[model samples]
Target: METTSKGTEDKGISRARFLAGAAALGLAGAVLPATGAQAADARAGRAGRPGRGLTRRGVVYTVGAGETPGTAWDPARMRADVRSIRHDLHANTVDVTGDGVERLTATAAEAAERDLHVWLQPTLGDVPQRDILEHLAECGRFADRLRGQGASVELSVGCEFWLFVPGIVPGETVLERIENLQNGTADPEQVQRRLTAFTAKAAAVGRSVFGGRLGYAAAQDDEVDWSLFDVVGIDYYSYHEHPADYVRELRRYLRWGKPLAITEFGTCTYAGAPQAGGMGWSVVDYDKDPPEIKGNLVRSERTQAAYLTDLLSVFESMGLYGAMAFEFLSADAPHRPDDPLHDLDMASYALTKPIRDRPDDPASPWHWEPKDAFHALSRRYARTC
Candidate 1:
């Protein structure tokens, strides 16, 4: 997920957690060589032979998709969620992401164990290139191990590093860097050059450890050199940036002749969220005591449902490799009926609405009711090839 105005990236990971994650993955400071059998499939990174290029029908499941969710270690809860994504959503692949290597590896391993093609994505925000590279190295090694277990896996090296990596843009922080990019204060060519340099280094790092296909999830304006990546993934929001034809907009990446995937795409649950694009969550006054919706916004599951189904159809028509819905659950954002001000789920892109406790069902502590969007996606994906 991109570091938005909400400061999800600032959740700061502990050194112990990172090291524990490294040890969990058997990362003993040595990059292993790929097996001779591993080279059977080339660009698509499939098993034994080259298969259909873009077969990942999926959803992007962040360990904690929202900033508040990821660090909570709950395998039973997470595994159940993964099962739902595979069985309920009918998705063949899952683009698993989050900052902590331990959580990233744990969540991705769960997906892989469920026989879902795991897209292991490591993300760290507002860090130096060195820190990002280190995160990538850890992920690459773990992904390589996962593939070695005979699972279909890919290591998407890093994400929007130009925005996350410091010193590339003039902004001291990610928000400042983004501001420079938006205001046209940052040099386009300079940004591209530096980004390219960092990506090249990242690709080299990936190849050194991971035998599987590698990629990066680019932001809307990123000028990625696709030659270094096997799959072209974008954090594509349907009406974001007011693009005339999203299919036409997506075709720009097809020029590279690489398989494409929508790394992340989903709108909030408000009335006009379909058009708000990435800023849909801005309606909430996060600084408030209880975090209330700023305006008198009407929550519409129908709007969310229709938007998702329509976009899935659009992506299918375009013959995409895959388009991962932004998320499966937003645990921290619970649904509060008749309370729009505190109904944080209105701003969440999750297919399932989370609830703190179900009054009637004491047997199940935390229960999530599938919204119309969830079933809409399931019906669409169930019918998909």
Candidate 2:
């Protein structure tokens, strides 16, 4: 039982006009509508023309996490950060976390004040199947709040279900849990049906708020019922078999005739680390006490930069919508000094140093500063907008 909004029916040709305008401007691969009615109004602002001012280059933004008062959503900090990013990287969008919806709204308001776009990444935490329907209903209410404020959200990153399942539970156990979870609450025969209905309902909320521009973030191979989303959202962490391979995979998604967004992508760049295969595949921690016998891969700053350059080049050449870096700032989590694997923790993946106090020793991985990959991305994005 999904419903379409009135604005969607009247905006059919508007979407086409925007895509055509992007294609005409040499941005031929993917076309993403900027968020909110302001973008639409911006289109209308161009001399009362019905179909102009659309661009192929999709909006670019940084990801912000954590609940830190000033670091996460301070208006002054957001303005300064957005101003710096625009100056140094041409990124115009800020993807704020869902739990911080009020803070995000405030940040978005600041962004709007500064003439920047704000994309809210809503999080649907792990829920028992019995609560699925209720959760979705609550999501609808949240979307209504955004709409009432005259704000539009870009993507509603639904449940990170994969992380909960295979990451924690074993193989067959995971499948059984899914079945039990669904059956315990709803009709067993309608599990898939309910899931699809729920996904569509959530997406509809986004479309209602954002005038039909919406997407979801998912694992690379996660099988999402396509009826729920308008674009392909995939996360690629270690898929850099080669530069052409990246292009090939992205092109594969384009064959679906929908825009693609690389919601998460990055490499560890450390040697002797085990990489996780696709979704549902077991993870192989290279630093395990009894290391699993697998292919050894070496990651370095130079390699990271090369991989990024190739991917970005392919994205730009194909005129795909746009891509966001995995993160903006380093995680504030502290690293454990006694453990070898501590160097590979979440904090290590940051492009910048942590604000928290740590050992000043040079031998610590925390001692590593921004590598060439950071500057490479900064340079490319800075020049693009």
Q: Return the TM-score for each candidate structure.
A: 0.81, 0.59
Write model 1 residue lDDT over 224-335, tens digit each, in one string.
6788989887887657433337655666667667878888888889899888665566666655766677788999999889888777766766667878887787666678
Clashes of 2: 2
Model 2 residue runs over 4 Å out of place are 1-80, 127-153, 157-194, 272-299, 333-348, 358-371
lDDT tens digits by residue: candidate 2, 17-103: 222222233331111212354234333421111222212222223323432322233455556655654455455554543333444
TM-score of 1: 0.81
Stretches off by above 4 angstroms in model 1 are 1-54, 64-73, 180-185, 240-244, 358-365
- What would you estimate as the lDDT of candidate 1? 0.71
What is the Cα-based lDDT of residue 122 in candidate 1?
A: 81
